[model samples]
Target chain A: DQQVKQNSPSLSVQEGRISILNCDYTNSMFDYFLWYKKYPAEGPTFLISISSIKDKNEDGRFTVFLNKSAKHLSLHIVPSQPGDSAVYFCAAYPNYGGVTNKLIFGTGTLLAVQP
Target chain B: AAGVIQSPRHLIKEKRETATLKCYPIPRHDTVYWYQQGPGQDPQFLISFYEKMQSDKGSIPDRFSAQQFSDYHSELNMSSLELGDSALYFCASSSLGGGRSDTQYFGPGTRLTVL
Candidate 1:
């Protein structure tokens, strides 16, 4: 069972525009959510993250919004640049039992930025 | 800014053989996690260690085992590997010190092909 789901397999946006990638989850026990950007033959790079306690978190051009009631989250990149084109993955962290838990990841969404 | 390092970026193994993958976490980071990503699929959690002790377990097969050493590096040992085991294995690390403790940074990943 996929606890985290990225419904969109791919997304395209023109440069200097906004790009939005969505993710959904079935588990409420997840207390932390993160977004990672990956390129071909490279590892996923840490982007932005939001804790369950907060509804949103932002870092530079990247912003992540979380809706706990809906069990959904979205990563938004404003004025998207061509360099931002890559595979974006949404991961959920279960923070129960006072110890670190494994991350559950979504299938990922390929983001393409057109120059 | 040293990142996580994974050795033997690519490996080809025959069925029924054994393979060992290694991971070197960032300095001062005490936790490590392992994940496997099969073709066209999301990453699946394998196992994790905190401060040289096994802290959590996931969907890792019985044929696989892993451990962390005193220096904070980790290894995943796979025995009697099967063809289905071909995948991209990633190692991620995070610190409990401060500032987004739950966030994880991933390595370039080891691509394992079982023939």
Candidate 2:
């Protein structure tokens, strides 16, 4: 079953505007959430993350807000630049089965920033 | 800064052949994870290792096997390769014990194509 979902497959935004990407998870046991951005032929790169203990985490121009009750989280990039265009994947880490953490990923959202 | 390293960024093999993918974690990183991503799909977890031991398992096929060495490097071995095995394989590393190393660092993926 798909535990994590990113319903919007694509998003388009103007440069210097706000870019928001959303993700939802069905597994409440997930304790850590992260966002990764990927370009064609490249591995996904880390963007931002928030632990379930907190509602929000900010890294400079990027902010991630998590709503635990809603089982949803979103990444907001302000003053979005054209270079920010890429496919973004939302991943959740579930510390289950007494093993190391395993990440569950969503289908990803493609962001196109028009300059 | 050091980043995760992967070898043979691209590989082509015939059906029934075997292929080996290698990953070298960043210095002092102790955890390794493997993921496979197909066209238009999210990365799926295969397995993870902690301190040279198997820590978690995911949707890995029976024909596939993996191990982490004492040096903190990991290798994925695929046997009886099939066309369906074509995908981008990524190796991610995390320190897991301390610091921002909790965040996983992904290497440039290896693209494996089986004909």
Candidate 3:
């Protein structure tokens, strides 16, 4: 069963605009959520993350909003640059306490910023 | 500024051969996770380790095995490799004691092609 899903496969936006990517998950056991950006032939790079305790987290130009009741999360990149074009994956894991373990990932969304 | 490091960025192997993929976690990070991504597919969790011990398991095949060493480096060993094993393997690390404990930093993936 696919616990995490990113319904949108691709998105296009003009440079300097705001790009929003969404993700949904079925597993309520997950307490930590993160977004990763991946380029062709490269591994995913860490973006922003939000714990279930909070509704939003921001880092630089990237912001992630989580809605626990909806089981949905989104990554927003403002002033999107052409270099921001890449595939974005949403991942999560249950952190009961001490150490965290495996991560379940969504099907990823490809965002293209047109200059 | 250091990130996770993966060895043998590209590997070509024949069916029935064996392949070993290595991952070195970032300094002071205590967790390592392995994931596989096939063509047109989202990344699937494989396995993970914490402080040199097996922490969790995922969809890893019986032909595959992995371990973490004292130095915090991990290896995924695939025996009797099959063509279906061809994919991009990624290693990610996270620190449980840091402020960004929930975020995982990924390395440049290793591309394995089996003929």
Which run of 10 residues does model 1 chain B get worst, by summed lDDT?
A: B96-105
Instruction: DockQ for every model, please.
Output: 0.59, 0.53, 0.60
Q: What TM-score applies to chain A of candidate 2?
A: 0.96
Candidate 3 lDDT over residue span A1-115, tens digit each? 8888999999999999999999999988888898989999999998888889999999999999999999999999999999999999998886556555677889999999999
Model 2 regions lying over 4 Å from their true place:
A97-99, B97-101
Q: What are the TM-scores, per candidate, against the unseen true structure? A: 0.96, 0.96, 0.94
* Native-referenced Cα lDDT, model 2: 0.91
Assess the local accuracy of residue B14 in candidate 1 as a C-alpha lDDT between 0 and 100.
98
| Candidate 3 wrongly placed segments (more than 4 Å) | A95-99, B97-101
User: Which 10 consecutive positions of candidate 2 chain A have the poorest summed lDDT?
Assistant: A93-102
Name the top lDDT candidate: 1
Q: Which candidate's TM-score is highest?
A: 1
Tell me how far the alpha carbon of residue B100 in candidate 1 is from the true structure, in angstroms, after superposition. Answer: 9.1
Report residue B99 deviation for candidate 2 (angstroms).
12
